[model samples]
Target: MTILDARESGLANGGPSFSLGNRLLRAVWIPVWRLGAGWTPRQLHPWRRFLLRAFGARMAPGSDVRASAKVWYPANLEMHEGAIIGPGVNVYSMGKITVGRKALVSQGVHLCAGTHDFDTPLFQLEAKPITIGAHAWIAAEAFLGPGARIGEGAVVGARAVAFGELEPWTVYSGNPARAIRQRRRFADDASNS
Candidate 1:
């Protein structure tokens, strides 16, 4: 299979392939992020933006990357068309992170793409991509742990900590990200939703 398909399958299975990708990406990422680490906030954002595009992140026109945010591997992180990744947000993609089209990742959100394997003797690092579905909204200060999945049109409340699958079209809130409600029609539920 092609690399993209392989990555997708690995994301599904969290198997050995994903682990290898995480290690390989981390190997290249540390030095690259270090090189640009000294940049001024303004300069750093644009440079990182360029690197992300160069690495094949399919960003659309007018996507803004503020200098303050940190991205581990530009090539390994994919934000689709019209996605808004706000300032100060860190996408620590040690494996792979795919943010779908028109998704909103608010300011200061932390999405970790790798973790440790407790089953291993050394507690070695294990990489798994975090997938944010289309049109999902991850509020400010939310933390998405490794291998977390946010479904389509879901809303992750502010400061929520999500370490597992979040159902689609629902509103999830609090530290462990419990789903509090399902989303109804936007026009119908506007007042209380």
Candidate 2:
């Protein structure tokens, strides 16, 4: 294909990572997400979880996604039991995003699993999977980029930006995220396992 054709192809999908059906699904879901589900009390969490599942998210019953949080495509998201996505979080799941059991994604955190191929003039969309392991905690306002993996029991500090795999049982902080210290193991850890 010609260079012009390649460029046109990138934009042809209307900036969506998925198919027309997915776009239509989100179109329908947006209203419900912002109005109906978003306004519901925390006591009505089951109802909200139903909506996410109906749209294809593989989430366990105990997981909680706050009212203000936004998940781009439910089909590309998965969260295990006890996972919590706090208020104002944005999960740009252009690809797969998995949160393990008891993982906590704090308020205003951004899990962006999509980017662009800057090398190409067309700036084609590139999607990668993000995985947060069991008991990991992504602190408020952190940004986890495509292909980032927060290992089991890891803790990410506020406003940190992570673009790669973080070690297990570690504490990370700052932009680009550095390992600050080892995460302390809980007394109940053995009991849970």
- The clash count for each model shown is 0, 0
The residue pairs in collision within model 1 are none
Pairing residues by index, what is the TM-score of model 1?
A: 0.72
Per-residue lDDT over 13-41 for candidate 1, one digit per residue giving the tens place of the 0 to 100 score: 54554446645766776566557543446
The prediction achieving the highest lDDT against the true structure is: 2
lDDT value for model 1: 0.72
Model 2 clash count equals: 0
| Reference-based lDDT, residue 87, model 1 | 77
What's every prediction's RMSD, in angstroms?
6.5, 4.3
Cα-based TM-score, every candidate: 0.72, 0.88
Off by over 4 Å in 1: 1-48, 185-193
**How do the residues 1-193 of candidate 2 rate in per-residue lDDT, one tens digit apiece?**
1122333233655553345676788898888788878887777777878889989999897998888899998888899888988999999988789998889999999999888778866576777889998888999999999989888889999999998889988999999799999999765443220
Q: Compared to the true structure, candidate 2 yields what TM-score?
A: 0.88
Candidate 2 error regions (>4 Å)? 1-17, 187-193
